[model samples]
Target: MTAAFAATPAFAKDVIVQMKNQGAASAMVFEPSFVQAMPGDTVKFVPTDKSHSAQTIPSMLPAGVAPVIGKMNQEMSIKVDKPGLYGVACKPHTSMGMVALIQVGKGPSANLATARAVKLPPLAAKRMNPMLAKAR
Candidate 1:
């Protein structure tokens, strides 16, 4: 006699990123600004303070992925299905260097260079440079 067992499917995880008024490194920042996630994982942007929103940088998106913009003080979740780097910014505070990086899957992607080449405001660039360097 043969016995049969039910198979359980793997579940996707939700990664939480907090938008804070003050972080350990700076003010008006995304705490844990750099995240590494697998494809299919969901990133939840939680606004811990008022006037903070999470929006995607167009030049940093993977091919076929649409840009996302969250309303200020609202919680937004994004499912990362593509394998590449994604750059996020706080619309109200981007000029103050409020930015983040999310690298999905392994290895560098084709658009990494393109993302790097996109010009950003001086302060935003300063904050993003280190996060970009950590990708891959």
Candidate 2:
């Protein structure tokens, strides 16, 4: 009987994504590289600092495309209706490791872990090194 009830999506994973500011000059990404959500599953992005946002976009999105940036609301939730790889990033600090790869459903339509290894633009690289050095 318990097993029958468990078949519902009530047990689907709920993730809390956090954005934290470490200092006046630096911030950090506390999001996971891979998150799995079923169709109807929800994910929350919480801002732990004054100026941070979690935005979702298509995988391999072009540079100028606008992302779905989450605001500093009291609470926020995102429902997954499609099975695909979603790219997440912080608007102002994405190059500083403020990026996440969300996999909806049982598998990712595209793998973004390797994309993380792609070389950053020269400016993005310059902005990221200082924060990374501090983290180390």
Against the true structure, whose TM-score is highest?
Answer: 1
**Candidate 2 segments exceeding 4 Å error:** 1-10, 22-27, 59-67, 72-76, 108-136
lDDT of each: 0.88, 0.56
* Backbone clashes in model 1: 0
Root-mean-square deviation of every model:
3.9, 7.2
What TM-score, computed on C-alpha atoms, does each candidate reach? 0.91, 0.59
Residue 9 local lDDT, model 1: 16
After superposing all C-alphas onto the true structure, candidate 1 shows an RMSD in angstroms of 3.9
Q: Residue by residue across 31-63, what tens digits does model 2's lDDT show? A: 443466676677787777766777774433323
